[model samples]
Target chain A: MIDAIVLRDAREHWRMLLSWAITAAALISLQLSVYPTVRESSAGLQQFIEQYPEVFKKVFRIEDYTSAPGYLGTELFSLMLPLVFIAVGAAWGSGFTAEEEEQGTADLLFALPVSRVRVMLAKGAAAFLSLTAVGIVCLGTLAVGTGWVDMSIGWRRLAAGTAVCVALGALFCALGALLGAATGRKGAALGISVGLALALFVLYSLAPLVNTFDAALPYNPFQWTLGSDPLTTAFTPGSVLKPVGVAILALAGAIAVFQRRDLRQL
Target chain B: MTTAPKVTPLRALPPAEPVLEVRGLSKWYGRTHALDALSLTVQPGEVVGFVGPNGAGKSTTLRILMGLVSPSGGTADILGQSALNGSPNVRSAVGYLPGSPALYPRPTSRECLRFLQRVRGIDCRARVAELSARLEVDLEKHIHDLSRGNKQKIALIAALMHSPRLLLLDEPTSGLDPLVQREVERVLREAAADGVGILLSSHVLSEVEALADRVVMLHQGRTVLSAAMADITGRLVQRLTFEFADTAAESWFEGVRGVAAVEAHARHVEVTVNGSQAAALDAAAKHGVIAVHSHEQRLEDVFTELIPERAA
Candidate 1:
């Protein structure tokens, strides 16, 4: 029954699927745009590395960016994942609770034999499925492009990055659902979800730039996304544990808030 | 075709068992109490009209029953289970039409019905067809494209299609045209005949006056009056109008015991009384009666008189 509801929502919201397809295509174009720059600057990059290896390495994950897998994952997962995750989450979340009241269809939904928790869970499942499908499509396209360019694909790193991004997408989707349930307004949910996502991203990014912040900043969800090489000898347990923890916490909060809330006024 | 399922389990229950029971139910939004110690019973085959003014807790009661709203302090039972404790058992057996029937804008009428049918887990295609035919709802248009009256028809279809054992309607006839209203009333009668319990809340008095067996009036989140239609109407005031020959005749009929209100016009004197026609005639004879006409009090009159006015 829950699967039916989720699948039905996906079928109904095929437009979002199309939009993600277009976005993925655009992202693929952007990734390839940087290929010529990397190829042409290799000599200069090598010279810089000789003079200041540590500085160059700190500025960019140079070894990872040289490969097609890293290049795509760098731009897409590191940059595009947050954007796509939030966009999809907001799109799905905008309709979740508020639409019931906004369209006055809540009375119809609540009058069904389904529980409120089931309703929220079903919608969250739909969002997760859609976001995961988009993530897979994006990663799959990048893998195929890497093969086309004759570059060795980092299957391990790609899988890890994609997994983390998928989780983050699911986390944001839950956040959107939570916001929707709390406000009972679509615009409010979108505003709060996107605003929080941006604020977290800024804190995670700029926190490392500050000299005093290195020890205090590793737990931020933003800090985990900065690294391009997802699978490596240097990949610490903290990188995997922190973002995953935040994602789990976010999802749990959304479900808890949604379960007890009254679904009236529609 | 041979049918093996002779008696559906739901149908085996006795008629005396209420499909819905609400007791001492109260809900407060912050400091403002929305429903206060409200209690009511709706048995099978009863059409109870829940009447009240704006902000009178009629909608709140229905919402609580539908499990859309939770009560602060009380209990409600639906089909033997606590209504607020679990996913409302009442929902499957109950069909609810809200005061404002807002539907999905993107889906066409056919698509909307299919969605609702899926949610309800019932194959309601034939039922939908039957109701649309009776209610004269056009199915090709999208919900947003339809007028307010037409949107109401789609909602009505969704609510009625399941052939639910109980119906909860809030202002069900606000936007409906008169012909559609008649059809809805007829459908309600048929549903009642089939042993369905219905609780209807509306400001439209004539629908209640015409269809309800019993009327329950609420005021400020509490039930103020509840009685059978027969009894209420019998107790209701009837206006008696008789034209007098001259002005001197008014003094002779000034303080008759049965007359509750009397208004003396230039040509005719109108008197409102609660009892026998013989007594009304006896009072009218003193005024030298020329013509006599009487109109029984409508539900509107009873409602207007019974509900105290809000203080300025």
Candidate 2:
């Protein structure tokens, strides 16, 4: 039953999938066209990397930037993935309950034969499917883009990074669902989702500068996207645990809130 | 010849133990009491009309029953289940159509209905088709593209498709066109006749008069009056206008037992009185009721009187 609801939601929100595909295609095409020239100027690139290590590190992890798979994995999966997930989460959060109320569908939805928890669960499942699909497209696009650069890809590292990206996306998805269940207003839910993600991003970027927060790196899902090693090594359970745990907890909280909330509006 | 399978009589069918029993239900939003000790019982196959004005607590009561909103002070059982007991089973057996109908516009009508049906564990294509045809809903249209009335029709189909034992409909006809409205009314009546317990809320007096056997009037969230339509109407005073035997004859009815008021003119006397025409006839006979004409108070008049003008 949960799967059915999720699948139905995906089919209903297929427009999101189409939009994600278009963006991913454009990004992959741009990378394939530009990265070859950058890689050929190894000495210049090395000098540039040395000249502004912080900027290089900020954009792409310099240690793994030599291999096209490594560079794209960090730059695309790490930085770009979060942005995509945040956009998706924002859309899901605002559209979930608020749209129903705004359109007057919430009233009819709550009146149905299914429980509110089940409805939220279905919505979460659909969002998860969408976010996962986005991650897959990201991974696939990068893999094809790697071929264009004549770079041999390390499958293990890409998979680990993609998994973490998907997990963090799921976290946002769950939060978005919770925000949706909390209120019937679209702008409010959207603000909460976007605001929370932006704050987290700021905290993450400034973490190295904050002396007190330096010790909390392991707990952050953002660190998981900064790929360490691939092909030769599998992902560490330690790095994956936090995102998986947070996603699970967020989903549970969403269900809890949904069960008791009036949802009388839609 | 072999006996055909016999269907049980509607009345003989046992009441599905009051899925929702509203008792002394009262709700107050801040200083205003939206529902004032309103109570009603919904038995299987009984379609009860909850009629009241805009501010009446019809929506509040339904919201409480669905566990969407908590009542300030009241108890209700949904399919013999209570929210306190942690039972979601009531939802499984219930189908509701709120005063306002809304759905996820991203899906086509078919997708929305199919999702609802799957969750309810009912293969309801036939049921959906039945209601769709009756409501004249275009299932192929994307919900976003559909008009308000069409959206309501979709909601009605969704609610009825599952064939729930208890249905709570609030202003189900508000957005529907007259033809579609009649179709919805017919469907509701048929559902009741088929033994589905229904509680319908509407301020459209004529619709209520057509669809409900009993009317429960809510005033300030409290049930001001609830009775079989005939009984309430029977008890209310009717207006009696007669060409008085003489203009002076109106004064003679001032002290009559059943006559509450009399307005006399040169050619006619209009007397408002309680009870049957026999009482008025008997009283007027004494004064030579030469051309007595009577108009019984309708359900609308009784409804108006029961709920104070300001409260309504």
Candidate 3:
């Protein structure tokens, strides 16, 4: 296990990984605990939701707040859950190579017998595993919450939604790794990662306001992950496959660039 | 009465195969030339000291041999395998300490050693313990909390624990105190005795003179000189101070065959002899030399003369 870079990374970053998992679990639990309160005041809450602006409701995906999946989607998975996963993915990807180079440790690492491609793959595996861990924590909390609240939410649908979240998280993680490998600078990688994430999210959120962007919804990662509201809509292969495919392409490009480029010191 | 024995001409023997061989290695970083057709070899059980100023390509040469960087031209081989490809089997036989080694800051020294051991596929727990004990390194201390000297000890242990066939050390004693440096020198000598070929790059000329079997000097990314330690010793200048019965004119020694430079005072004369001291002493005796004293040449002086630009 120590020989594999992925396991090594996990061992080194266990504290951060655990913190992310706990954060995801805590957020999900808090959102689920408020379900009964929201249900009891459904009539008044529906009145308040109706008064919300049309664009605001569209951006937040607010529809039938009394429904379990809809409530969870808005309160948990929609923004908060994906945000947690995105941050985790971006951090892992950037820290893998960029942080090592910045800290002057790349020379020690690259001097080993292992090829650079293998090292990059190991880092990608670690990031994927960490993101999956956070997704699992969120899924487990949602499952337990449903049982505690006696909600009629299907476990199968919850599992499917969590899978989509993992894929979406992986896309951003790959993006961060690509930028880090190309630039060898943690700040640049992370800044571009967060900026792109925000830009794609805004583009997807305001798609209804612009006809051209609405037509380009298929190209937006945010639309791929949040467009269908995985909890309420039927699972589509395109939703998961497109993001996963894009992630693979990004990772391939990263590996190629890293292979040819010289490793620089801080 | 004794008679001189008959002398016979000696025949040159074939050269032995080198444990490490580099040929015409060149590295260019855009418009900058880091190394220019540098070639060298280290035979088994030999320690070759690489001496140069900063940016003189000592680190670049070592890095290329370790496969950390690719050369723009030429090839490097260790144990008959190309270092550029750096197969695992080939790398497992090599121990390298970079100019500035960086270990994981979070792990203890022991953990880092264990991780490297696993990576290298060496089952030498006893060796690790022995190296740590010899180096006086506390294995349980976190790397970030350790002093620079202690950190250097850990790096040294990691490089030596594997007992590799070839050791590529760059400034191995940079942060070490005198005692630790002596200890490390002892370890290197022991490794050499056991037939490990070592290529040590350092700016410390005295250490190089003390430990190297051969010295290779680099200047401005080029090999300025490569000579056996004995040859260097033979060519080393000797400073001769003479007190003549009478004032000796500097011109009296100006035409001496072995004297490189001469200085004359009212009653004392000093001459730097690069060849036989006998030749210079013979010339000084003609000036009615009353007394003579000689000082052995220092490697620092030789280094300055070899790389005069650096001295400037």
Q: Which candidate comes out best when scored by TM-score?
A: 3
Which docking class does model 3 fall in? acceptable
Q: Whole-model Cα lDDT per candidate?
A: 0.74, 0.71, 0.82
| Ten contiguous residues minimizing lDDT sum, candidate 1 chain A | A226-235
lDDT by residue (tens digit), candidate 1, B1-312 = 110112223434565788878889999999998889988888888889999889989988888888777789999887666778645445677798888878878879998888777766668799898999999988988888999889888988888898988899887877999999999999999998998888989888899988898899988888888899889988888988887677534554566777777778787877888776667688777657878898888888888787876610
In angstroms, the error of model 3 at A79 is: 1.2
lDDT, residue B63, model 3? 79
In model 1, pairs of residues that clash are: none
> What TM-score goes with each of the models?
0.89, 0.88, 0.92
Compare candidates 2 and 3 on TM-score and give the better one: 3
Which tens-of-lDDT digit does each residue in A105-214 have in candidate 1?
Answer: 88877677777766776777777778778777767776666556555557666666666666666656667777777778888888887787787766555554556545
Q: How many clashes does each candidate structure show, in the order listed? A: 0, 11, 0
TM-score of chain B of each: 0.89, 0.85, 0.89
Model 2 regions lying over 4 Å from their true place: A53-70, A227-234, A264-266, B1-19, B28-32, B83-88, B244-248, B254-257, B282-292
- B12-94 per-residue lDDT for model 3 (tens digits): 22347777899999999999988999899998789999998888999888878877677999988887777887455566677
Q: What ordering of candidates by TM-score runs from best to worst?
A: 3, 1, 2
lDDT, residue B20, model 2: 53
- Cα RMSD for candidates in order: 4.1, 5.0, 8.3
